[model samples]
Target: MKRTTFSLLVVDDDEDDRMIIDDAFLEIGYAGQVKKFMNGKMLFDYLEQIDPSFYPSLIVLDNTLPKMGAEDILTLLKESPAYQSIPVVVYTTSLSPSRQEKLLQKGVYACYQKGEVMEKVIELAKQLRELAESNSPKE
Candidate 1:
């Protein structure tokens, strides 16, 4: 069977981290599209205009954001009937296993702790790609 490419919505405040995520996607040879936002407000504003049916396959968000954090965004998405199905992966530099577990309980698909190493980043990228692809809309 043929596979469909994923569409990812990423929310991060750091330019370098954003670059890393973008580069990771490239390293994994991701075939999907990635849309990035520096803040949650902008992401929400954009999402409001898009059709729910066309929502991205995955959402990769940062724990610390300028306005709304990852938890807030996840809560908002989970509360929305139109967006609840989309998978969310929290990517953060903090190493809080308890927080990660809480996020998982709150409905995020996965939590990945960001690292500086290229190999680790590449591995994370591969995992993200697998997750995004696996959760893509079934034809």
Candidate 2:
């Protein structure tokens, strides 16, 4: 099966989830890069350093990242022009309506529920592929 190329960045402190995403991508033959960051701050800092042209096609932000403050990151990204253009997707098990609203208000592309299993990770990769394809500029 042919797969769409997508550069995805996952922000979550959990090592297992990171590995799960890595494994799921490999299983589905997603050859594009999947960069993992332990927190929002690191991701923000890295994005600052790298050229915006190198931005990931999708960003998966886990709600549980500590110290880096997920909500704050969302708000900040929403305010910045360059960061605001990149699609942000919240990937966390929490399904609170308020949080979801907050993320939407901040302009998230979509949100997914994460859990102990790798099923969510695999599903997310599939969805992200669709997102990348849909958002691609027409020739």
Candidate 3:
């Protein structure tokens, strides 16, 4: 089967983190495209004109951001039927209990500390690629 490149959305305020994620993707030789968004508000606005069928398969979210925090954006995402199918993975430095709890409640598919982000980002890309190629949702 011809593998389709997965589309990943990197929603982070920090430029460096986005670069790291991009590097990780390149390292993995992933057949996936990543769209960078510095803030959720901007991401949301951009999504307005996009077809829901092109919704990203994976969303890498940073815990903290300006203009719009990850939490608020997640809330809005959950409320949108068209955009809710994307699996969100929280990759951030903060692993505080309160933040973790809220993230879990909001249905983050996975959470990883920034220390392990590079490895996890590569893993995430591989897993999503497998899922897409197999035409099945990961269990």
**Per-residue C-alpha lDDT of model 2 across residues 36-129, encoded as one tens digit per residue:** 8898878888889876666676777888778866677777887988977777788887769987887787687777887566776678778876
- Model 3 clash pairs? none
Q: Considering only N, C-alpha and C atoms within 3 Å, which residue pairs clash in candidate 1?
A: none
- Candidate 1: tens digits of C-alpha lDDT, residues 1-139: 5433238888999999988888888877773577788998988887888766667888899998866988899999999988899899998999488888889999988888897897898898788777777877888
Count of steric clashes across candidates, in order? 0, 0, 0
lDDT of 2: 0.75
- Per-model lDDT: 0.83, 0.75, 0.72
Cα error of candidate 3 at position 1, Å: 23
Candidate 1: worst-modelled 10 consecutive residues by lDDT: 1-10
Candidate 2: segments with Cα more than 4 A from true spot: 1-6, 136-139
lDDT digits (tens) for residues 1-139 of candidate 3: 5434336777888898777777776787762466778998778876786766556667778888886777888888888888777677787887888878879888887776775556776776566455434533344
Q: Give the clash total for candidate 2.
A: 0
Native-to-model Cα distance after best TM-score fit, residue 49 in candidate 3, in Å? 1.4
lDDT of 1: 0.83
Top of the candidates by lDDT = 1
